[model samples]
Target: MTFYDRDQELDALRTSFESPECGFYVVYGRRRVGKTALLKEFCADRPHIYFLAAQEAEARQREKFIEKIAEHFDDRVPRIGGWDEAFDYLGEKLATEQLVLVIDEFPYLVAENDSLPSYLQSFIDEQLQNTDSMLVLCGSSISTMESDVLGHESPLYGRRTGQIDLQPFSFQQAREVIGYDIEDAIRSYAVTGGTPMYLTLFDYDLPLGENIRTQMLSPTAVLYNEPEFLLQSELRNPARYMSILEAVATGHTTPNEIAGATGIDSGPLSKYLQTLRRLRLIDRAVPVTASAKQSKRSRYRVADEFLRFWFRFVEPNRSSIEEAPKVVFDGTIEPTLPDHVAPTFEDVCEEVVWEKIRRGELAPYSEVGRWWYGEHEIDIVGLAPDDDRILLAECKWTSDPVGHSVASQLREKAPHVRWGPETREEEFALFSKSGFVDGLADDLTDDWSLIDLTEVDVCLS
Candidate 1:
């Protein structure tokens, strides 16, 4: 449960705190992504007042805020009539000393009193501009945070000196959190999806299957109802959004295909998809070589690993799970887990490629993603539009070693990717789970590279 990353974010906050002028910072991300944890870590050494807001009356919220200020500063609680008065009390303290006032879950306060932002704006403009104190507004509601506080039309716009859109951990960081081997780490990443809270829930002492059974499959488990809770909390109508997500997780990627699968009409499907995209639940993928704006062959996919796994395995088999959790995992989940982990393995391989680029082992590329056209598909493609160079890779998650035929097939599909000049430079890479055939190395040249699972671990590390 130890904090693993966010060095850059902590550094940014430290710099702002050490600055001479007052600092106004906004931090927001989806729930359980560690926004609060990061803020607490940053405030551990600083003189700060941290107040967590809840869904309550405005008066109750203000009373709690006053109590926190009083406790932090060891001063008597003041009689505040409104937010303006509350700021006046804090402003008097800021004039004498520096303080970091963080209101965690700022959206809840905004929900109760919509004019709170205006009061904070006035406080910043009129009182705290010259002080060395800081104010951090943190929230988990992405929509409310972006539209109400960070939006252009909001009264608090143009006031923030800095912002942190905290994100989930990368595959490497997730692996570090769970302390699993490369293969098991890949499987765990597929289930946890880089969410720090979920990763911390995993008992590293237990096996992966046991963890999945206890932490995810059981009806009493925390994660069993997690996806449902998140959807209900964030969206007004969770049923329709659940249906769309279920369709995408079960292989209905295109708009028409999802509409056919979910029985939601195509006209309104775009709106639902857009909302899901905004929530970071689903992603729209196009060919790596194609323009995202103009690409006709776009595909929708469940962006969250846990949600995709839940929809694919958990949601569809709730009855079976109720009957017997162990039976469901062994009979249904165990046999097909490799196939489920394959896509994540491809993603890890792509991350390895980027890591290589960072280490100067590979040249920089403009974009990297899967490439598909008609019947041809490439697992990983790196396009460097500036130098007319393309890196095409094939990732195999099978048990057997990849052979020359796989490389040959990748070569055959490379021409179908209409990128760069006909005489452009090309490179081929084959990423495998069980390494490559001994004979496959003989066919390698300066342009050909063979990467195995161990090499992937090393590259990413």
Candidate 2:
């Protein structure tokens, strides 16, 4: 596959690239999520210089940037020393012509020289602000970007014209990339979180479980050691980060639970959790109805599916990768992977169907989300945003057809809904990986219903 999704994002970036005068684009995301790739794709046909910054001293990185500029613009590499000199020269050289300049993993450069952003911002004010060059700053260190470059206190704050928080592929795109049903695609997405590089390993030809074993069990595989690579890159103490991730991944969502599980006190761990949440690796979510942003009952979830899979399966069992890697991987990780991903798989399905619903693909849904009464949670709830029509969908990963018993269970929970009886009427949809029960569709004829993307296609068509 030649990559998938991101069409809208690519179009947006391309439009920025061809901006009439000046433009600065900030693209940041968690590691291995394809920020660099997306930039390259966006700037493929344009006159651009793609400079990937590395972890070296400030002077050395500046020299590297100069050298790339020289190579791109001339035969001999430039002898520039400071980053300011390189930017100054580039600004001067491209003064008359439009060019795209991309600095990938820009946080590395910012880290090496604390004044780099100031220096660049000054140059932008003095030189490039009057030119047509499009400057693109890309980074995987979201926490660094937010704090150092985009933060209000930073010199570069408010300097960017457009910012792109590049995200992983969506479940629908994942299906298109390799081909799979909504349920299976969601299951895969729950594991890989729509990441293109990670999704590349999934074989459209094989079963998800088999693919996970083959692609993730091997020590040399991309995803096998993904967590370590990611943590080791952005963090000072990889061990502490690993402990924190494992605690969260193992179903300890509260600060107290994570701290207790990781052997870190809640007080100190709060800062680290905040950092992780800011970086978008983990999320602190409250029930949607809650008024408070952060409450005592708030839960933490690995917002990135790849990270969740890594923490749940890889991080906790690093020793397995060390000794008899496959034995430990297939034996322990594979066995627990399915149950761990079931709920997420359901959520992904809901998301894909929801998107379709929004585009008039799945009929007119007034609202969509997990509706609950006290403790009973509906897997999928679609409301007629305008009317009293409500859709209560139960997504089952099981092979059997959804039975009538589930309908009764839903009815019991329906009364708890604050909606008056006249305001809400229930519709049924049983999303099953193995297909709905015989007569199930016929029985739901009186109400709105759909299978996978069936309603999606009808509405869209």
* Global lDDT of model 1: 0.91
Across residues 1-461, which tens digit of lDDT does each residue of candidate 2 receive? Answer: 47566888888887876777688888998777778778878778888889999888888788778777777777477677676777788877777678889999898988888888898898778887888888888998887888787899999999998898877766655666655655566667777777788888788789887777667766677788777777778778878777888888889888888988988987889988887877677887643333246545577888778888878877667677667666775688656766776767566557656766666655677456665445767777766745666767776666566666765676666665555356576676665556555765565555645454343323222
TM value for model 1? 0.98
| Candidate 1 Cα misplacement greater than 4 A, ranges | none
Give candidate 2 misplaced runs (Cα > 4 Å). Answer: 75-81, 179-184, 206-210, 292-297, 317-337, 361-367, 371-374, 382-391, 419-428, 442-445, 448-461
Clashing residue pairs, candidate 1? Answer: none
Give the best candidate by lDDT. 1
Q: Across residues 1-461, which tens digit of lDDT does each residue of candidate 1 receive?
A: 48878999999999999999899999999888999999999999899989999999999999999888878778999888999999888888889889899999999999999899899999999998979999999998999899889999899999999999988888976777877888888888998898999999999889999899999999999999999999998998899999899989988899999999999998898899999999989999999988899998999999888889999999989999988999999999999998889998999999999998988888889799999988888989999989999999988999999987898888988899898999989998999999988888887788988888799888877
Question: What TM-score number comes out for model 2?
Answer: 0.87
Compared with the true structure, all predictions reach lDDT values of 0.91, 0.73
lDDT at 14, model 1: 91
Clash count per candidate: 0, 6
C-alpha positional error of residue 4 in candidate 2 after TM-score superposition, expressed in Å: 2.8
Cα lDDT over the full model 2: 0.73
